[model samples]
Target chain A: MKPVTEAELHTYIDGALSEGARAEVEAWLVAHPEDAERLRAYAEQNALLRSLYNPVLDEPVPAALLAVRSHAWRRYFAAAAIFALGIGLGWLVRGMFITPQMLPASLPRLAATAHAVYSPEVRHPVEVTANEEEHLVGWLSKRLGTTLKAPKLAPLGYELVGGRLLSGPQGPVAQFMYQDARGQRLTLYVSRQRGEPRDTAFRFSQEDRVSVFYWVDGNFGYALSGEIKREQLLNVAGVVYKQLNP
Target chain B: MDRRLIIEHIPRLRRYARALVGDRYVADDLVQDTLERAWNKFYLWRPGSDLRAWLFTIMHNVFVNQARRRRYEIEQAMEEVPAVSVRATQSEQLELQDVDRVLRSLSPEQREVVLLVAVEQLTYEEVSGALDIPIGTVMSRLSRARERMRQLLGGQTVMPLKVVK
Candidate 1:
């Protein structure tokens, strides 16, 4: 039998050793009375530590800690509002000099707002489940007058949860929801709008904890929204863009 | 990063902070600062990584910075006032106060290792990652901490160290 080191003894006390190593340590401790006594003291110390601090877990989290989320949300919305105001001012100023076709559409902002409202839902997150993928695609395609395909995001650890039909300014919008193993949801919003067939570059925007990456491919506008980091959402956006465009 | 995902770790963060600082208000402040910093730098956090360990690392760094600042304040205050030894009461019973005193008797490094292992039940790997120390250092510090704790709690008077802020 390999001799148990002091670290192994500590690991035994922590209950982190493998079963075989734990058995070996226990056997060694039984043979050594002094080591057994020391282990007892360590166990008692662990109990005391838990007794002293574990109650903090049971205590209601102070309001200040809970306020962190709300504070972040407030900051996000404030920034988003400022950004929207800037865009609105820019459009107004630009409208004076250019035609309506030159003004960018507000579909991205709409998609972001829809994502913020619906992604956090515990229930009724989508109108149809992914199990009905064929029917869902057919229905959404007919409603939006485009061949709408739910992007396969399994490679990214996100599976299609479902989708819903939302009303857009131009026509119907199809929102396909995907969720990862961690229950984080991302929404892909697609709608056919009056735009020339030109591959527009991906534009990014954030609104109240939700990030959106939107672009136009021909007449269809697509936006991917999630509460993930920008780089991660961009990766997912790239995957969606390839699937839809290919 | 999702705010909700970060929010879910609040209770554990508070518990760890309280164990580190040994004061409710100070610990709460540390937790708040940690959360705020985490929010601001959420972009730096990698997805699909160990979020809890990452949060703990942030908390550890914040606590160390605050401790340094508070130590400076204490040094300035000590020059103005006589040095008073705040010794733990000689109580052998395993009461909560006795446990707290014994824990406070340890140096910050030892205390952190001990609390993270014994109280937070973090694995040695996790503690190493949280404290940014080598795993061997965590084990050695933890061993020393346990020995010191035994000596102190057994009614042996260890030398009074500087005040833990």
Candidate 2:
């Protein structure tokens, strides 16, 4: 019979050993009374730990935590309403403004273009990867003169790949990239804008293969672009908006 | 992935966080943060992967980050003050209170491993994934943690205390 290693014993206590290995450990334990006694002690310790903390699972989730989902949906509806109003207003003033100055591409279009250019890159997708999230947030916050937090997107099935600093027409732009399990990537482009805080509305636009959901909050304009459906992108955008606003 | 499916893990997340932080309010805050983060990046989660393990991983990262920030705060408040150590002696019989104290007495790394394995019932591999540690490291830590727990609880007999007539 092979000797039972300490690591194997640990795995046995953890209930992680294979069935055959477990049978071997059980047979070995039956022969070694002292080892069996020690295993019993380990089992008792696990029981104690569970008895001490498992009641927490029965407790009602606090209101604050429950509020996250409700708050997100509320923001989603608000953004949708504002978006509808913006579309209506855009059509009303479609041909009214023809100024001599050529209007630069809208931020959403610029963001989608940027997303198309970078999201497909296999290497060098971001300047600073998500592994250095603290540095990424700090650098971008400093460069943009606003506190920027990279939204946690793990629940939405995207992990931050990295972020980059890009030059915009107005100032520096921060682009955060996230990749899903299937290797699909999304980019969040944030830029500083100087104007009366005119819009807090969320707007959607598509450029080629990428779709963008953009919104202006305070001094920052955020554009989330990906090759994803509008409804799905809207849900992600709603989360980003709530986090940024909160 | 459906948000509802992620929401189903909240109770377990809270349980793990409560054990991890040893504070109810702080645990709830960690859960809230974890949920918000998870909801935002829900796409990154693989369709058939263990959602619970993924949530625990996020909670672990949040807990670590918060601990790092709090350590900074403590340092700033009292510079160069050595932390006081509270050790459990074997003389104390392993009552429930003693178990609580001993669990809290563990170093954070050991405490997390023990809690994830014993309380949360996560497999060693799941713990390794959640903690971003090697499986060997997880096994070694679990071994040490279980030994410490045994020494702490070994002497106690669970027989009821006798009452004088």
User: Which candidate's lDDT is highest?
Assistant: 1
TM-score of chain B of each: 0.79, 0.78
Grade the docking of candidate 2: incorrect
Candidate models: Cα lDDT each: 0.77, 0.74
RMSD values, in order shown: 11.6, 19.0
Which candidate has the top score in DockQ?
1
Cα lDDT of model 2 by residue, A67-186, tens digit: 354335444545555576686664444334322111224888889988988888888899898889999999999999888899988999999999999988888999999999999998
Candidate 1 residue pairs that clash: none
What is each candidate's DockQ, to 2 decimals? Answer: 0.28, 0.20
Show what share of the native A-B interface contacts model 2 retains.
0.50
iRMSD per model?
11.8, 9.4
Q: Tens-digit lDDT track for model 1 on A122-167?
A: 8899999999999999999999988889999999999999999999
Q: What clash count does candidate 1 reach?
A: 0
In candidate 2 chain A, where is summed lDDT lowest over 10 consecutive residues? A95-104
What residue runs in model 2 are displaced by over 4 Å at the alpha carbon? Answer: A70-246, B72-94, B154-165
Complex DockQ, candidate 1: 0.28
